[model samples]
Target: MNITFFIKEFHLRHPVIKEIKSALIKRGVNLDFVVLKETILDLQSLGHLKFASNSDLVVFKTTKYFAEHLAILMEDEGLRVINGSKSIRLNRDKILNNITLRKSGIKTPKTITFHSSEIKKISQKMFPMVIKPVVGGRARDVKLVSNKSELEKNEKNDDIVIGQKYIENDGLDRKLYVVDDKVFGIFKPSVLTPSDNSNAFKEFKVEEDLKEIALKCGEITNSKIYGVDVVLGEDGPYVIETNDFPGFRGIKNAGKIIADFLYFKKNEKR
Candidate 1:
């Protein structure tokens, strides 16, 4: 079977790109790289191409807006898209996903989603608040707001916002990759402080109970390839967020596991 991999740009040097290519090759499955930069100006355009192109499966190391758009387009084409558009959209938006999880009886932080005008009301509810973009990703604009003044300052920016009471915990954030209802790997996100601007997160061994949360989250998102980030709170484990396409780092046998899944699925059709 032919699997098409989507990327922002085509490069032989990137480790993730190379890893996907090499792993697929070893299993004797046909792989092709589709670079968004070469063919389209934006995600919408790139998405159109994926719908037109032929492939048995499409996989991504991480989720992006364009990747999400592509999934929707593929759905229109009647192609079976992995991590379909709806799932990606939910996972990328902290406010929406948090609301959904809470409604579903899943544990999430107490959140208040609102327009910028609602900051005054939000400030009244709690202090030592955390503020982040409702739709932002890669933790690009995550911030901690200590009080009303800080929240008001951020309000000037007219973007959808998710405000929540910051849970002060010493526990590290965990990353869990669930493939087809099974825990493929677990990782601990590298520590970050206010002073550190670096986006890198580290991986560690899977916690005993964390796997259960990950699997439950996977079922909630309804995506085959998804990642869940959770933190240990005073009450118990609380899910911070869910990712549609989780990045694989420092996970043993990740590439092989993913490649094997593809290999087996391809042969099963024939």
Candidate 2:
């Protein structure tokens, strides 16, 4: 069977991807990769790409606009894409992801999304909130603001942002990685805290409630392989974010699990 990975060039060197690639190669599966940065998507001629046309399964790894558009086009041609374009688009927008989770009765922190121009109009009561880009990953530019001055000073007045009420938790973040029906938890230092060993990740037991929430997020977003960030708040656990095609850095044997899932999925009847 043929399998194609649509990813950024940097992802080719990721340990997890490397391991998965090695395993797939050992199994003698035909594999191809399209580096998004180097490839051009010709909208006028959709199905002409040899990689997409010959693949039995396409792993939609990158969330870039071009990759998403191509994935949508591939789906239009009846090719199966993991985590689908809709799921990637939904997870890309922090505001939309929060709204969708809340509408689905999922417990999430109180969030307010507004344009940067309206920053001064925000209420002071919302101080001590976490301000982050509406569409971002890896917690880049995420900040904790205690007042309007800090909020205005920390965030640029040119893009959309979301101010989420900070949920007090022990300085550890519960990162739950979901692979199909299975879920694995990893404990790591919170992004707000300064940790010399930020890369340190340890395995943790996945509680039933957390597992349920993780699975529900998958169902809500229509994602099979994803990650859910949760923090233990005063009222149990609250989901912080859901990431599509997350890097499963902490899970043991993650490459094998993911490869097995892909092989089974590729061979299964649609």
Candidate 3:
């Protein structure tokens, strides 16, 4: 089968990307990859790629816009998409994901969604809260605000934001990657200090319960692959968020897992 790997032009040199490309080539799959850069002309390139599409599967590693656009074209051509438009769109937004998790009876952090105008109202409900953009991943636009003054001082973006009480922890964060209703891998993020927040990921491992939650989360999201971040809180293990098509920045063995899924017998279905 012909495969079109859509990776960000800036991230083409990442080790995981190289490894997957190489493994797919060895599998005798006709792999064609295009480095899609972030630019004003991105839409044009996306259109060209869609129009020129000939692959049986399209593996995207970038924004939802590209995935959604390509998914539409691919659907017209009857091609299968790994992280399809529906899955990507549903899991990317924190608000939508929370709704799904709640409906699925899965345990996630207690969250309060509010308009920018309701920021003060949110402050009254929770303290030592974590505020984040609804349509975000990998801790982007996530802030830990301790009080109302801080929340009000921060400039709000266009995206809807959610505020949730921060659960005090033993200071370890777990990232669990789930694929096809199974726990693919779990890593403990590496951190230099408890307060250090420059880099988003601290590279941690597969605690059995975290693995289970990861699997359940994958099933809930209905995505072939996604990352579930969880924290050990006062109540229990609470899911921090679900990320669709998340990056494997500092995780060990993640590249191999992704490669195996892409080129191995298990991924033969789609």
How far is each candidate from the true structure, as Cα RMSD in Å?
4.0, 1.9, 3.8
Between candidates 2 and 3, the lDDT winner:
2
Worst 10 residues of 2 by lDDT: 41-50
Per-residue error at 82 for model 3, in Å? 0.6
Q: Per-residue CA lDDT of candidate 3, range 23-117, in tens?
A: 77777878777666544435545564654377767776765445556666666676767776666767767788888887887777678877667
TM-score for model 1? 0.81
In candidate 3, the residue pairs with backbone N, CA or C atoms under 3 Å apart (3 or more residues apart, or in different chains) clash, namely 187-204, 188-203, 188-204, 188-205, 189-202, 189-203, 189-204, 190-202, 190-203
The TM-score of candidate 3 is: 0.82
Q: In order, how many clashes per candidate?
A: 3, 0, 9
* Per-residue lDDT over 1-270 for candidate 2, one digit per residue giving the tens place of the 0 to 100 score: 899998888989998899889888888899998777845657666643556787889997878757667777789989989978888887888888999999999999889988767888887877789888888998998888888877767776778788898898877889999999999999888888656555448898898989999999999988999999998988899998899888997789999899999988999898
Q: Which prediction has more favorable TM-score, 1 or 3? A: 3
Candidate that would win on lDDT: 2
| Per-candidate local distance difference test | 0.67, 0.86, 0.68
